[model samples]
Target chain A: MSRFIEIVEVGARDGLQNEKVVLEPADKIELVRRLDACGARRQEVVSFVNPKRVPQMAGAEEMIAELAGAPGRSRIGLVLNERGWDRAVAGQCDEANVVVCATDGFGIRNQGASSAEQIATLAAIAAKRQAEGGPPISLTISVAFGCPFDGEVSEDQVVAIAQEGAALGLAEIALADTIGVADPWTVRKRVEAVRKVIGDIPLRMHFHDTRNTGIANAYASVEAGVRILDASVGGLGGCPFAPAATGNIGTEDLVYMLERAGFETGLDLGKLIETAHWIGGKIDKAPVSGLSKAGPFPKPAE
Target chain B: MSRFIEIVEVGARDGLQNEKVVLEPADKIELVRRLDACGARRQEVVSFVNPKRVPQMAGAEEMIAELAGAPGRSRIGLVLNERGWDRAVAGQCDEANVVVCATDGFGIRNQGASSAEQIATLAAIAAKRQAEGGPPISLTISVAFGCPFDGEVSEDQVVAIAQEGAALGLAEIALADTIGVADPWTVRKRVEAVRKVIGDIPLRMHFHDTRNTGIANAYASVEAGVRILDASVGGLGGCPFAPAATGNIGTEDLVYMLERAGFETGLDLGKLIETAHWIGGKIDKAPVSGLSKAGPFPKPAE
Candidate 1:
């Protein structure tokens, strides 16, 4: 059976947040231009957080204003609290992503809140969004697989949080392997369990290639009926709080596998690789994508 | 259900062959000692070939004779022709692995023989082994997934070769993604097809992490009920002939996935990572393994 998979491009937001080099607003806009040229219809373009704490993400409002009102593209803004949520709504983001950590250790460190506080805040944001009528909002459960500070995260913890998140009537819900400690079998089992709790809500998956299991986890999620996956161009981004955490699965690498297996990902492989190298140059880091170095199959006829 | 899978380490031979630095026989032996320390029961320690052709793979005779007849370890010698096969038999290798290229383009460049000629050589060697009662022989179909020279190797091509190889009463048959171009879905289908042709014979898989699909491909192979997989320490190895080809799947990386997924791989993940770093130091190259850089999960109490 032929399938269509949506890869939510995260290179502009999650990708650059962990980079040592900060991109200016114009450069960030240029990066989004390349992503749009590569046929990315949905992208996580900004995180509405304290720029003082994360200087790399200082120009979210500027980038969002410049990126506003793309006809077909949906620009998502990640907001962890009500203040950030207000900033996202004020910025006219196409979508808002709410992140709730599965463990208190990661929650306190990453978002300056506890797991229970994040869930309660998710409820408040959903209620406010329902009354105020802003852009669509989705919930992402971070550290659903494992946490760097708290050690192993239990599926039961993630399931309970997903069950609560599903009750909020959001657009979609994602399970993020924030530390990249997920295996395919564990991913399949967790996806199946989380599906039982969140009925009819589109399940998205976010993975890091920290232990080289990101692609495999993505494959398992797809096989388990997850349609939306988060990827970064050139495998950019890492968890600054999570020790030794690396970049997300490369968008071109994911597209390469999907297209080769007869799945339509609505992505151009040549352009993706080209953009990967382009972003790597912009960030002054080598692209961690395999397709960039290995090149596309069939040798490109020359 | 619980399961047991075997990982055949290939660091010493395949892992080192593509390195720019040529290792001495003593250093190669030191590498094997590390492999043995990591509880690798089966390893492709050496390849019998012309030293002039592959200088990195020289001193195979000395290394094999020194490592002859380990109590529980099975040292496999890779042989491409009748002459190498004779050398394998003389070296008292625990097992002999004969390689037959899936395409004529690769067969000529890699082994100086056509596909049909390699099959003929396989048949002759099998007959001689049957008459002489030497070490057990296995067949490996190199580039079973894709060929760098020919490109897009068909499943029918591999299945036909596997059918012939199975008919020769070999120990096991392996499909090598020599250029690391295979995807998980394709791997499952091809493994099923090859299994139908090669009845009851064990199926092994060798993958390179060239395009970052090796772990995914290995997970697919195990799910398809293929027990044996080939990995190299620190994810070493590349194709001298194939442009931009990189390392195999890291033994530590594979073990981390399998052990986390509850499959018995009988490998020490810690030792594998240590060996990856050790070999990288010996060769003066940083390991390509994610685990070497990311470290193991659960924080290791540090």
Candidate 2:
């Protein structure tokens, strides 16, 4: 399909959160602005978590406060609990993304909560948002494909979570391959199962490229009628809880695939590669994105 | 479709041909043996080309002669011209794989011929093999997606080559993304187009992960009813003619994707990763295969 697909740029948030190098708030802001300039309409700017737990995601308030709002750009703030939701509201984030886990083991290790407990937390925040009128919220189910400790997350587990999530009237529900263990067939079937249950809340997909199945999974999602996806510039970020967690699908790589295939992502490929290089240098690591290393197709007419 | 998929291991030939450090003949044979032990039934073991042109692919005869015949294992030799085909036949290769390029620029640079000239050479070799009853042969169209020297390769060019190839009654035909510039939708469409022209001829796909679209392209090809695919162990190899040519799609990564999605590949994932590690050690470079770095899904019960 040659339709428009929304790419949620997570380079500043998910891309940097799991990185060892803790970027300065100014550097993080600069990274977000650079990606925004590259036509990232929606971006995950910060995660409202304790600095002790995720040190790299420490500057939620400062990062949000410093970023001058660009028209039509949504700065997404990631939240894990009610406190994180309050922080997102206080920081005036364009939107808030709260996370629930498909497996209890990942929920406990990643956010110090069980799966059921995380859903309860999500329900509470949704109710508060409905009453207090905060930023629109979306729920990401982590380990929706497979788990690091539990392993082989069931389709029933994810669908059941999505069902409970749909009841909350959230803006969106995302199935995340937290450890990148998903296959395309499973992805298509799961997306179908989730779609039958959720009616039309608009499904978003988040995939890690740890095992290199991210692009295949994304392609399956797109074919299964998903229009929104999460990607990181430079293929940055890895889950600290998951062993050998590689970056999310690279924003540049995803753009190259979609644009080449005639799908409009509204993200500039050339600018994305440059942003990858800029962030890669900030982290003192070369971008793992394929487009960043290989350059765009047709050689760009140097 | 949970059908059995045949994965052709090319780590020894296409994988190592463009590498910098040329391995000893014994090492190359060892590498082939390791992959065969991991259930690689058909493998591209060497290329019958001048060592002066491709030093990394030298000692094709010695490597083939050293490999003891294994039951059900077919050792494939890649040939570019009539001389190379003769060498492969003389060397007792179980299969001779001839090359026909989709573009003239890559053919001239990589094989010292134009596209038409390469096709003529392939036709000549096919005729000789038919008359003499030599080893079963296949044709690989390199840079079938895009060329480095000549920008975009059209579907008409590749389909035309496949039509000419099918007329030779070849055992198989492969479409290779030599520069790794293909996307999933294009791959699906092109595979369908080529399949229409080459009736009942088992279509094989070869891809490079240079743009990180290899897994997606492979997934699309499989969805398009392609059962045979070419992949490398440890994600090795690059094209010397194409700038920033990365490794082929890793066999282990492809197997993981297929087996996890309920497709039978008859390949061992653990052994494949070990072979990747073993080969990577010999080359003094880490295997770039995603499964090599992330280990297998479900963590292999470790």
Candidate 3:
């Protein structure tokens, strides 16, 4: 019954982090600024990880510095450990996001720890940030739908993770379909269980269009009372560990479907699609968003 | 809720008609036979229009004759007027389909008549078929959601047209999103209205994936409790009149979604996807079906 949805623009951090090309800090800043201008309030601008491990995210600090204090926009920085948390505080992001993989295989493969250890670290950071009166912390559970190494992640695991995140007093908990293997039924089932476990804590959904069910799953989540969605501009970003995994759901495509389905996203679709095409040209690949390929409905005048 | 859904495969006729290259009749027959082998009971094999007008539909008679005695499959042929209807009867198609455009602009442009005139002609054809003990007649209302030249198409018009089609006692009535301009909201609204007007007469849905809303719209229609759907294998077919128009929703993609959503489509997903890829190679471009591009979910083992 909720009519308003908040879209979290994650192209800069999530998309570019996996892209083969290490985009210049200026390009990342420009992309974030463009997204902000198009009415994106929550922009995951950068991830403060080891530059050696993720060279694509090398300019996190500089990107945050450039995006700080932008009008009517919030800059979100990703923090994986205590060191990353220190960098996020120094960068003065509006919010800090910590991700804990749902499966131990993925946790060790991605964050070099088990899900329990990572959740404990994020809990400590959440406690520290709240006491220090710094930026709020949000928890993202990666591979919430299915894991590449572990395979067939159960809804019970995701619910347990969400309960831990809720007990930590995180502001938001995002269930990520890391490999884009979720269908609508699974999305509904998991969202229902997770919501029951973490009552009153806002739920966010992150989906990949790898199997072309991202939009349908997102719509199901909306019907299940979820308001926050994570998408990337130009459909960039693919999971390196997941086989046949494609990019994240296109922000403009999701926005278009949301608006057409009678939900208010508070984002400009025209500007978002234009930005997608522009950035796609820079990356030297055609955008995979359906709206971009088909153009706007009702056939905009020639 | 209906557990069984019938899929009307239209790739052979609708897809190849609009394609640039002409396929030999033997190839068309092969495609239809393969689709039949994959559990498609309803296949629109060809149209009975003038060969000179539509060079691609030149061998409708030969194609039908080749498929006349196929087991457990009903071959459908399109008939625009008396001549086409005569040809369909002579070809001994299992069913005869006539399309009445919703708007006069489209009706005149596509069928060379007004909506009323075309409806009258189709009604006469239906009566004649019933009296002559010929194939059952089905009506397809093109542009039921919106029109290219006429712009917005009112729900009242569609309801009125459905009322007329219902009066003819046709076997089935299909509401087509001819330009793929429909979203979930519009699909729900139009389907609700049309279903109310034509009670108990089977309703089929035809969706185009132009703006990428086709799959979502189809899902919405299923939630609306419609039992039959029209799809093109390999995601072929585009409207020449509607700008930015794309192909119909892919049969394999729809089957995958429906089966995942717990509906029985009676079609083999593996065979359907394989047939899509095989047919795509014979065409000039890649297949537009998303399932083809992403492969099936769960990666179905190496």
Candidate 4:
């Protein structure tokens, strides 16, 4: 097992996108800045997509542009198409993350494209990014474990998409339990399948705490040799397309678990928790993170 | 891995004991009956503690009397002393669970006895039960991972308590993360240490989701070959002795994870979720169980 794990902060993009209240560009920038100051080395600061489709992400370009040349952190931007990919590169994103829906049902519902069409678009974007030769690209297979519209997603389907991404020479490929419907067994199986196809490509995991299996799945993923995990600070995430989706795994809670399990995350837990509390208050609600709810566990005497 | 896992439904005792509002004795009996009807094989129905100390458990004898000879389930009761043990047997409890603290501080505060004194009492009770041949006793070590007063509890302390219980010929031994301070690594290490001392003795696990690692620890326990898991319906549990100690692992949520991970728990997920919702409504609140919140994961078409 790796002694260290990299946490990709996604609260600014994925977490806030699902919330009912849309924060101003300034708030989004400030949230990312606070996270960075608290040792967030890599983060999803924005998503370059159609504002009409996702109004919460209206000022993605502005958010990224404002954070460009910032100190000590790498900014990632979510892009779903060639156009969005172009926008992310223009805005100086350190990494461009493209998501392909695993099942056709979710692809159509979420992105208005079939799975094949989405894969084709991703292939074009990958080619363009490879030619551009600066901002690295990564692929996230959404609803890889299970889809709401399509109940059971086959491992073969997920691996097929991963293979497409691997062929593009993407830096990383992530499997997202978009609807939080994965057990550890499924997580292990899917991760193994994807790894078998994409031999040396790094794998990341995205999980939601909707059914309360997110932490368990995360642990399973870690045991399966996954190193990069995407989490929201306050567990602030849900699916706009998938019905009844809830929070992503809370970053503070995830960090607590990882650090206790002997994985060095290099993030200050106290500061992260305070950040969750602050943002939750600014949003006029309690944070959904369980560790935030439980306060901090007393550290064992060294 | 054991395909079949034993879930000891603890809603009636551990679940309700932590709630601020007390339920009527009849309501408690009805809760146990419903759990049994939903195929719960073993349950902690009530605790035979002093009514004045814990008024919520005021009707332990009456509740057990009402549940005595109830069909299709084994009822267990918590007993702290010889008096409580006598009451449990008289109330026709199928098993008596006695908790011995792993640290002196928690023992003094929670049970008004040192760890040594508690073990001595348990040993005497174990002798009597062996001679009488009924109502098998089990020992639980609270704060087996870390204690609130004592910062770090030694593995030797936990192993020592398990050794004492093993010498007493207890039917099973459970190590409880009383304050939910255990990580998966600690759980695996502790379970291994205890197993080394008490070979072939059935080991049970009790986890509080206080620090949000309960489900993760439970998964690790299962991977470490643990079969019996204790959980509360609706996540209804908190340690009255340990400040800020929160709910136990939610039974419905745990069952969902286990069954999906290919462990057959012999539990009706739908019925258990319905029971959670019913009880939560009866208490005029929503259930904390995640499965009850998200509804069941859609089963694949056979």
Best model number under lDDT = 1
Question: In candidate 3, which residue pairs get closer than 3 Å at backbone N, Cα or C atoms, i.e. clash?
Answer: none
Q: Write the per-residue lDDT of candidate 1 for residues B163-281, one digit (tens) a residue.
A: 99999999999999988899999999999999999999999999998888899999999888889999999998876544465689999899999989888988888888899989999
Candidate 4 is scored at a TM of: 0.97
Which DockQ values do the candidates obtain, in the order shown?
A: 0.65, 0.72, 0.41, 0.55
Off by over 4 Å in 1: A241-245, B241-245
lDDT tens per residue, model 3, A1-302: 77889999999888877777778899888898889878899999989899999998988888888887677888999988988998999989889888999999989988899999998898889878877866888889999987778878888899998998899888899999887777777788899999998888898999887766777788788878899999998778876754334589889788877886678999888888898887787777667677777666656667
Give the C-alpha miss distance for residue B162 in model 4, angstroms: 0.7
Q: What are the interface RMSDs of all the models?
A: 2.0, 1.8, 3.0, 2.7
Put down candidate 2 lDDT per residue, A1-302, tens digits, no spaces. 44899999998988998888898898999998898889999999999999887889887899898763668989999999999999999988889999999989989988899999999999999999889989988999999988878888999999999999999998999999988889999999999999999998999999999999999999999999999999999899876644564789999999999999889998889999999999989898888888988888877766
In candidate 4, stretches whose alpha carbon ends up further than 4 angstroms from where it belongs are A240-245, A299-302, B239-246, B299-302
Residue-level lDDT tens digits of model 1 in A1-302: 33999999999988998999988978888988898999999999888989998888898899899897899999999999999999999999999999999999999988999999999999999999889978888999999998878989999999999999999998999999988889999999999999999999989999999999999999988888888899999889876644455689999889988888889989888899899988899889888888888887767765
Q: Give the best candidate by DockQ.
A: 2
What tens digits encode model 4's per-residue C-alpha lDDT throughout B11-117? 99888887887899999889988888788889998888888989889898888887866666789999888899989878888889998999889889888999999
Cα displacement (Å) at residue A104, model 3: 2.6
Tens digit of lDDT per residue, candidate 2, span B1-302? Answer: 54899999999988988777889988999899888789989999988899887898889889888763557899999998899888888888899999898998888887889999998988898889878977888989989999988999999999999999999999999999988999999999999999999998889999999999999999999999999999999899875544454689999999999999889999999999999999989888888888988888786654
Task: Give the DockQ (C-alpha) for candidate 4.
Answer: 0.55
Reference-based lDDT, residue A150, model 1: 90
lDDT of 3 at B202: 95
Looking at model 3 chain A, which ten-residue stretch has the lowest summed lDDT? A237-246
